[model samples]
Target: MEPSNKINFSRRSFLKTSALASGGMLIGFNLFNACKQDVKMPVDLSTLNYNDFNAFIKISPEGKVTIFAPNPEIGQGVKTSMPMLIAEELDVLWDDVYVVQAPLDTENYTRQLAGGSQSLRLAWEPLRQTGATAKQMLVNAAAAKWGVNASECKAKQGVITNANGETLGYGDVVLEAAQLEVPENVTLKKPEDFTIIGQGTANVDIDEIITGKPLFGLDYKEEGMLYASVLRPPAFGQVLDTFDASEAKAMPGVVDVITIGDKAKAYLESEKPNWTAQLSKSKKVVVLAKTTWDAFKGKKAIRATWKEESALESTEFHNEKLNEILEGSKFNTRRKDGDVKKAFAQADKVLERTYEAPFLPHNTLEPMNFFADVNDEKVRLVGPVQTPEDAAKTVAALLGRNIEDITVEMTRMGGGFGRRLYGDFVYEAAEISDKIKKPIKMVSSREDDMTTGVYRPSTKYKIAASIKNGKVTGYHLKEACINGNMYGLIPNFFPAAAIENYQVDTANYKSNITTGAWRAPYTNFLASAEQSFFDELAEELGVDRVQLHMDLLENVKNNPDPKIEYSPDRLQGVLKLVVEKANWGKTAEGTYQGLAVYYCHNTHVAEVADIEMNNGVPTVKKVTCAVDCGIVVNPLGALNQIKGGVLDGIGHAMYSDFVFDNGVPQSNNFNSYQLIRMGQTPKVDVHFVKNNIAPTGLGEPTLPPVGGAVANAIYKATGQRLTKQPYMNNLQAKKVVG
Candidate 1:
């Protein structure tokens, strides 16, 4: 289940602050526009406060609607885009809706996470309901005043008007509406009646973001705040042997050097954590700091050794074991359709392929950071966190504080492709706060953040397909990897891939490398293997890749891929839509190349990548995409996410990945790792399959397909199927790294 509650946001309590968040200005909407109600929807609060405010929104005496955003904004545009969701249903002018961060009350918030592309999709139902419900309540209140049947009154753009056209603004009836019981149900406007749902609303926080507003963890500047940094073992499980802090203490801006070697509990359990977890390990650490830089920079001054576990390296962290296990391992047969072995044997042609993807980092633009002030009595935390409830619980358990004693204020994230969802770093912050007996803000350098990240585990895919008489017959997908006990998590993780004679067999290679959610997680990896493999199989059968996939997808749409608990209609729809948009298999002139698509999250997305090999460097000129996620909370916002996801994937495929030696991570800074720059942004065309389906996630599903598309296009250009990531260097080493 794509449940946001997985992070346990329900466990935390919010400590109310006297500070009023802020006011929002609503933009004008087209009035008198005819609207239809094609899609039935729930009308009421869409999101909850991380605090105990079940009402995600409230209308002030001035008619301003205040929406409490549950998810951290983190450069995902939720800060601006989500509020638009609430406002769309509330039937208020954009100018009149003000947005604020929901306080830390896990029970009140929806999902504080910014991954899975679900922020908008999942929130669509509740947020729209929130606005619609409030609108109904106000309309009723207005009707009671004007003595008209509620049906005779229409609430639009903050005004409740009679059929005769007499009206009162929302502010005029605010008190009565607030006192009235929240409505039991309400009807939403039809798409034709839409005034704001799909409009190109600019980011609500653009001014703040552009003006260097103090809205992020880095902007946190409370007085008496001390900065902290930790020196963790290079790898998890290794124990710190010796520490010499003499030189670190003598450094300028250096206050003190501290050592912590814990055999009982890793890092002191504090009612308040330091909010800076340098690394993920059950092991303890040594601390040094005067300034964050001094603490962070002093790592060079300390001499430490670790007793590495022999099993650390002995337990192979690769898929060679996976190949061994998949061929001989006793796996639960996920699907057995039409005697796949018999079908393969009868086929005129049989193809087998194996693909692998290394571990990936959730390189959020904003490094993970948190500010904490923990004392014996209570602890306060401020940063970007996906699961406040989990963070609070972890802090409480570590610090011996009641859940009520901890307060987590989630800030706008710089960007979180599933990285901030993990609560470990937040736990670390809480620990440091309690340890130092003072409030501390821990800032993770990009180096620390990227290297210490929980990665998308390396994965392997072994596949075979049968092509008979220019027709595809059977398919097999064998997947292997570890993060969760994959052996147990698949009917859930790769349902689509595990269809047909699909077998999901996994072997664990647990390591000190912290692992957490990264966008669509394993699905992205499988998309490359499954989609690309399917593309090749189609070619083998003398068919267009699009036509081939459409055939398979049509078969699986309702046939129910046994390995998948969910049907594949959504995936089929997106695949069809993208192919149509890209004009798949149609000859295109010039140096451009072509590719196909795949799905992730609950959403479906497909893309056709066009590239020109210039000086051996692949110049991605344009990308055409199609997505079907049901409703559009904000079409502009949705499209931007698709565009951004594509670019991110393009950038990673070109120049991002971590390398390590003897357990120490390489590619620490920008020099080692390169981000996509303005010079390389390809033109992206996003086509949405407009429908009334409850929205699904958009942030991640669009990403996975792009990497393979680019690779496929490069294959078309160079005739070499490039399988490895950050293919830029190899291309560039051949003198074409763009």
Candidate 2:
């Protein structure tokens, strides 16, 4: 019951036909590299079968190859780059290949989540194997027909040729190939032979995007789908007391006014597992209508009373609690090396600085929307979800249905930035549809999307550096924030492994405001604080900023530590490359340059931002970034992602922050909050370190360094070192877009 005309292999008849075909290989691979699945895969595969895979390519009778990308594409270019891996190994021309977005099928595609920027890293080998295995099967099919050894035949650009000058297009031999048993051991192509991996390529959907095709979650539609809008509380930790929807229910086109309290309660107390039930337990009243405007109008007309929990407090109260925790000596140590106290006490001078970053909302372009149809037979949901399998599980838990009965199809996300990582929206949509026993499309307005919970946590880092005779002798960092210890904040955040006497202390502040990963997660704010501290330390020691970082990296390189997760060589590699490209030592009039480097998501990135002060307001003119994420799959796509990350980082650091008053967010819409406009965006140049390493993630690694780079550049321009974020606060002047 698919809405689109695209071919789907999950249908029972397609599998039966494929299984009957000769020499066709249906291979299903798991994300064994991530999620702690350390079982070694052997080449021996006498037990291999076509039913064991979730995604595969089939060569039709017309020489067309369609590769399915399992992971969600949140503007990260995964939808195109993943197919490139298959095409490169399959020896097929890019034009001959078509890419398909795979629906969530955990039985076939295990570990199908796109967080941590591990999509490319995890899929690199398995996808290549899928293509290579199919290619080997096709080559064998051609060899059997030619009565020659398989090695003598080669697959090139969807055609198989023999040494005797015999040639057959892959479409001609696919039926024969589908009948043969799949080979266990298939050779993969070397990097030197890659014709498409490193080349610049446009997104596959660019044409559709330019022509205004329906590809995103917001564009989803159906014949009998009803529009829905929910009336949620004004803030987090608030409960709906009562609702009077008489006026709304009597309005034109209004179908129903349903309260979500009973469904939410049943979900939490249901027999199904409640792994994420707490997140999905939000209570709201839904308005179902014939159209989106009717639903929105009905929602606005509804009268509701909300009661704020007594424990939930204001932003000022939370900051006070944060300050109290920072001042308190009781702290949990995450990382520690040499005696930091002795090093600090004996050093010639000790510099201390505290940096703060506020909560940020994921302002996705499309907002949150999902189409769900739930009935006694089955439940089907489709929308822009980063983790479709997880969303299915959540819906299954909520609806008391089998996971297999819940079908969750992923659509192209307008933006993710980790906000879509949660399946609450999907669960919400499913519960409403199941309650109404009809297909419903739940859409979130910009205000609903922004004011809802799950924002980037407001964090503060108190850093102390001990300097003796122009060298950093010791470093201590105490991070005070809500759930700092839980959200992957390790002891060796940055500069910790580089310094000998280093320690990381953390204090957790209690708050009702929800926070989740935004872009690079903790590294985003950490880089802003750590890199700015290094700049301050460089100035205090009378050393160049670029040289100062090099010295620390040299120390880490020469003296390695096991606690350090990043390679000093890689960190140094990007720093050197970016400094050279930015012309660090050289200066131009009307511009000041600042540099910063960070390692995360198995990738190292260095950014140099050039800023110009106009009427005391800083305007970023240009940015040069160098990244080392191993092989660049689709250089053009990678460059676009990097540029987008840079602009995203600058925009968030410059103006994005969620303010709360009595547990309610103040910045509800664009009018209150500012986003980086086209005029304010800087010209960007991106470069990648040439290496033979496997490709890592590019979705978020480039973002962590942009804020620090721009902040350091602003310091150089204004001489005033602004400690707090939204550095524009220091100027107290209006934001000038240039």
- Tell me, by lDDT, which candidate is best: 2
Mind sharing the TM-score for model 1?
0.85
lDDT (0 to 1) per candidate: 0.64, 0.79
lDDT of 2 at 637: 89
Give stretches of model 1 more than 4 Å off: 1-51, 107-111, 163-165, 261-290, 310-323, 330-338, 482-501, 557-577, 586-592, 729-738
Candidate 1 residue-wise lDDT, 116-216, digit = tens: 55567655545555566667777888899988899999877888899888989887876566556545445665655678877888887778889998887
For residues 1-738, write the lDDT of model 2, one tens digit per residue: 111212122112112114223333333333333222222222223453322346556566777777667678889988999889888878889999888777876665567777888888888776676677778888998899989999899888989999988999888887787677657567777777789899998999899888989999989999999999988878677888888999999999999999775666676666764433335345789999999999999999999998865465777887887888889998988888899999999999999999988888889888999999999998988999887877888787667798878877788999998888876677788888998899999998998888874788888889999998778999999889875623657565468678889988888876666677778877888888888889899989999887888888888878878878788888889999998899985877768888999998889999999998877779999999999999888899888889989999998888776778877889888999988988999999988899878898898988888888898888777776767878776545333322
